[model samples]
Target: MSRILLVYTGGTIGMIKNPETGALTAFNFDELLSNIPELRLLEHKISTVSFEEPVDSSDMDISDYIKLAELIEVHFEDYDGFVVLHGSDTMSYTASAISFMFENLKKPIIFTGSQLPIGDLRTDAKENLITSIQLAGLKERGKTVIREVGLYFEYKLYRANRTTKINAEHFEAFESSNFPPIAESGVNLKINHEKLIKPNLRKKMLVHKSLNDDIMVLKLFPGLSQQTLSYLFKMPHIKGVILETFGSGNAKTDDWFVSLLESLIERGVYIVNVTQCVGGAVHMGKYATSERLKRLGVISGGDMTTEAAVAKMMYLLDKNLGPKVFKTIFETSLRGEMN
Candidate 1:
């Protein structure tokens, strides 16, 4: 039997109600199997590890990201696949960071959770967990086709690096607008074999534990003042910027605003522009307003989600490449993250 590891962090998927306070809180994974007995039917050796102190996903940070990376690293060789039960709040961010950490990886890391507590009747946790395992362990032509980090929720399995949470109240909390889903489960588990990421078998998976956190995301809005831009550019040691621009990469055309970005680029700051829209590409210079930004040497992020843009920028900057070379690489599409 294939060994599937369940790394249960804190989320609504593992919650129970307190009898006294009548409040929903995280329940023990020891009882998780009972809640989702369908998992026993799968032909896999299941094991679990929970955090010592569970944190709401909103509280997730770089340190927790490192811990999760370390855990996956330590157990990478032994497990056929892994599932992470995480809070929906930052699941996309965590999953995206992990995708960067495990560069050129060749295994499935499926992240999932539920909007409603698993102990509740209407909870979507059971379906998400069961299908994640099935997709993770599936084989094709005597080889595992899916070989990367992914997010499984609401009957969809998406490449983790390409995902972003777009909803809060609905069961469909995650979406991969830039890329097609890896798999989907309806009447039967449907694997998009073509969409699945195949690794470069010649290379071994390299796990990166170090992620430079001195990054900021600036959202471009109408009437965004020069003073605000001035203070941001002056922030100490800010290594990278993900500029969320208007549709098709349109930004303010004012010279002073463009000049600030130009100065920052000269000062060795890596700036990448991603579309603020959920389902579009960044075509810098295609229009008049965005042409100035392109002229300012801002890297076009193409179709990359804001989460992927942030993680990819940090990963490249962590390589310690100077602004000159980093701009070239940041614009290049490594995966299908860009158009």
Candidate 2:
């Protein structure tokens, strides 16, 4: 039987309603099988490991991501696949970070969570949890079907780094604006084989745990003051910045603005230009406004979501590469996060 490991890192899906107060409280993973007995019907041996103190997704940080990576590394050879139960709010961030951490991953690492507590009568938790596990366990001829990190929710399986939580009140909370869904589920689970990421099974899995979070995301707006820009760029220890620009990566061409950015680049701070539009890539020189940014050595985040860009920057910064090398790799698609 296939063995699947459920790593619960805390989320709405693991909460139970209290009988007296009606407030939700963290539930025990030991009761998972009993709570959802349908799991027994699957032809897989399911096991779980949860955090000692369940962390709210808001508090999730780089250390927690490293801890998760270490957990999977320890049990890598024993399990066929792994499912991470994470909160929907920051699921994209955590999922994107973990995707970069694991290199040459040959097994499925699916992240999933629910909008409501599992104990709620109208909860969408059961379906998400069950389907996520099934997707994780899916294999073909002794080979895993999905060999990369994915986020599963509302009958859709998306590349983890491509996903963004787009809703707060709806059951379908996540969306991959730039990329297509890897798989879909209804009466049948349909795997889009062509869209799945192909891993090099010949290479051993390498986990990168060192992530530098000394980065900032600066969203550009009309008439953004030089004072504000100066303050941000002058901030000490700010190693990188994800500049969320206008459509097709357009930004102010004001001389001061361009000069400030150039000054930062000269100071060894990497700046990446990403589009604010949800569904488009950054074309740095497509317009005159962005041309100066291109000339100033700003890297283009082509069709990459902000979450993915942030995670990618963190992963790359830890490598301590030179400015030119860093720009080249940042523009390249690492872990299929960008085009």
Candidate 3:
């Protein structure tokens, strides 16, 4: 039987209803199994490890990323696959970070969670948990079909680095607008084998725990000014910044604004241009407004999600190379995250 590890990092999926308090609270894995006995029926032998003190998704940090990476590294040999129970608020961001952290993975690392507490009768928790594990355990030709980190939610499996939470109340909370869905669930879970990222067998899988968090996402708006642009562009030691601009990567054509970005680029700050729209690619040089940014040394993010771009920027920054050296690295496809 396949051995699957459930790394319970804390989320609504692990919460139980309390009769007296009428509140949801974190419960042990035994409690989860007792409440939802269907877990006993999966094909794989399942085991869980929970955080001593569970963390809310909003509190997630670079340290949490390192912790998640360490858990997978230690259990790599023992488990055929791994499923992470994480809060939905930051699930996409965490998933994206881990995708880059674990390079050339040979096994599945699927992150999943739900909006409602598990103990609620109307909750979305059970199905999300069940399907995630099922996806993790699947294999064919004695090889794991999914060899990268993924975010499984509702009825779809997305490339972990390519997802973004677009809704709060909807069952389908995540979407990969640029990249195609890795898999979709209906009568059966259809794995998009063509889109799945294949591992580099030659490179040994290793985790990069150190993630630089000195980054910010700035949005450009009409009537934006020089002072505001200067303030953000000149942040000290700010290794990277995500510029969310108008359609097709258009930004203000103001000379002062352009000069600010140019100066930042000269200082070696990596600027990544992505669209403000939830679903679209950044087409550099398509319009005059964006020409300044493209000419000012901003790297085109193409159709990458903000979550993916942030994680990718952090990963590239950790390599400690100058921004000029990372020109090819930022735009190049990694983990099927970019267009």
Candidate 4:
């Protein structure tokens, strides 16, 4: 039997409606198997752990992320896989951070949660939890099929760093425009081997706990003032910026805008150009507007989601790389976050 660790960091999946107040509240993980007895049928050795205090996904921070990595590190050898319960609101961010946290991962770390409280009659939690556990425990020929961090929702498994929560009300809250689903759940669990990341099992896993949250995302829009742009780039501790530009990474070619970017780049502020479109890669020099940005040493976040871009920026900034090397590494795919 496969041993799986169900790490409940708290989210809608662990909520139960209050009979008197109608407010949803967190329940203990010890009651999980009893609440959903169908889990027993899977016949896997399941172990669970929960945070001391439940936190809403919106309240999650870097400390919570570090705790999660520490938990996995402590229990790394005891479990075959891990299933993380997180809020859909910040699931992509957490998952993206975790993807960069662990190096040479050899087992699955599948994140899942629900839109409604698990105790609700029409809750999507049960299936998500069950399938996530099953996916975690899956192995073929004594080798695990999934060897990376992933987010599973609405019957589809996506690369965690590639995902973005696109909806606030729908069950299908996450989307990976730059990448395809690594696996799907239907009549039978279908694993797309070609899309899944293959890791070298021989390398020992190293967990990165220090994440510099000094980066910011500056999304460009028409009529945005030079004063606002200047203030953002000139912020004291801001180390990097995710420049979300027009389609295909185009931005205004005004002299002021170009000068501000040039000054920031010279000041050692790493800038990455990403597309605002849901489904396209950033080709820096494709248009006249974006060509100048490439000449100014702006890095291209090729087909990367903003969530992943933010996490990657934080991860790389913590390393304190030189300007030239940092630009090269930022454009490269460290954890399959970008193309």
How far residue 106's Cα lies from its native spot in candidate 3, in Å, is 0.7
Worst 10 residues of 1 by lDDT: 330-339
Winning model by lDDT: 2
- Two-way TM-score contest, 1 vs 4, winner: 4
lDDT for model 4:
0.92
Question: What is the lDDT for 135 in model 1?
Answer: 76
Local distance difference test, candidate 2 = 0.93
TM-score of each: 0.96, 0.99, 0.97, 0.98
Query: Any runs in candidate 3 off by more than 4 Å, and if so which?
Result: none
lDDT of 1 by residue, 274-301 (tens): 9999898989889999998877788999
* lDDT of the candidates, in the order given: 0.85, 0.93, 0.87, 0.92
Candidate 2 residue-wise lDDT, 211-279, digit = tens? 999999999888899998898788889999999999999998888999999999998999999889889
What lDDT is reached at residue 56 by model 2?
Answer: 93
Compared with the true structure, what per-residue lDDT tens digits does model 3 show for residues 251-301? Answer: 888777887888887887888999998888999999998877877779999
* Residue clash pairs of candidate 1: none
What is the Cα root-mean-square deviation between model 1 and the actual structure? 1.4
Candidate 2 local lDDT, residue 316: 96
Q: Clash number for model 4?
A: 0
